[model samples]
Target: MKRYAKAVWHGSGKDGSGHLTTQSEALEKNNYSFTSRFTSTAGTNPEELLAAAHAGCFTMKLSFVLDEAGYYPERLETTAYISFENGAITASRLFVAGIVKGISLVDFEACVLEAKVDCPVSMALNIAITTEASLTD
Candidate 1:
């Protein structure tokens, strides 16, 4: 399956504004601007979108990995931080809290690692990526 989002920008770099539209229109004309990206603003930005994608992908991958390992996950919560600096995206950090049945901490950590490497968004990103995984009841 292939997916794509389109963006259109108007005006100069620092003063320009843009909106992103996805094929399914789930994010319809999501506005973004230099202020939104570089400073706090009332609109969505690319970095936040990346963070969302990374978090969703990693969590989904972790669930699959756990199931394949003969474990059932009761809950999994993931947060992703995307860092942008010097005109480049520098890093992505994933924090995962997991609760599962029939898995040791060591094996749960191994599953988390596998998800970190195998998730599509993680694989697509060229920047440094790290993950912190914890198993909690």
Candidate 2:
């Protein structure tokens, strides 16, 4: 299966504005600009989208890993922090919290590690990927 998104940009890099659209149309001509990317402007940027993808992918992969390890999570939450430096992405840090019955914290952490390394998005990204996981009652 293949997924695709489209970006349309106009003008110079610093002064240009763009809109993004996904195949699913979840983002239909969403706006992005230099200020939105470089400063605290109200718009979406590529890093933000990538972070969302990473977080979603990691959490889903963790759920599968937990299931395979015989642990059913009542809830799982993950936040992916993408760091962009020197005009490139430097790292993705994942913070995850899960509530799963009958699972030790150590085991939960192991599962998180496995998912962190095995998620498609993590594998696709060339930057450093680190994770911090906690098991919550």
Q: Evaluate model 2: give its lDDT.
A: 0.96
Model 1 TM-score relative to the real fold: 0.94
TM-score of 2: 0.98
Best by lDDT: 2
Candidate 2 wrongly placed segments (more than 4 Å): none
Q: What's the TM-score of each model vs. the native?
A: 0.94, 0.98
Task: Write one digit per residue (lDDT tens) for candidate 2, span 12-97.
Answer: 99999999999999999999999999999988999999999999999999999999999899999999999999999999999999
The C-alpha lDDT values of all candidates are 0.93, 0.96
lDDT of 1: 0.93
How far residue 24's Cα lies from its native spot in candidate 1, in Å, is 1.6
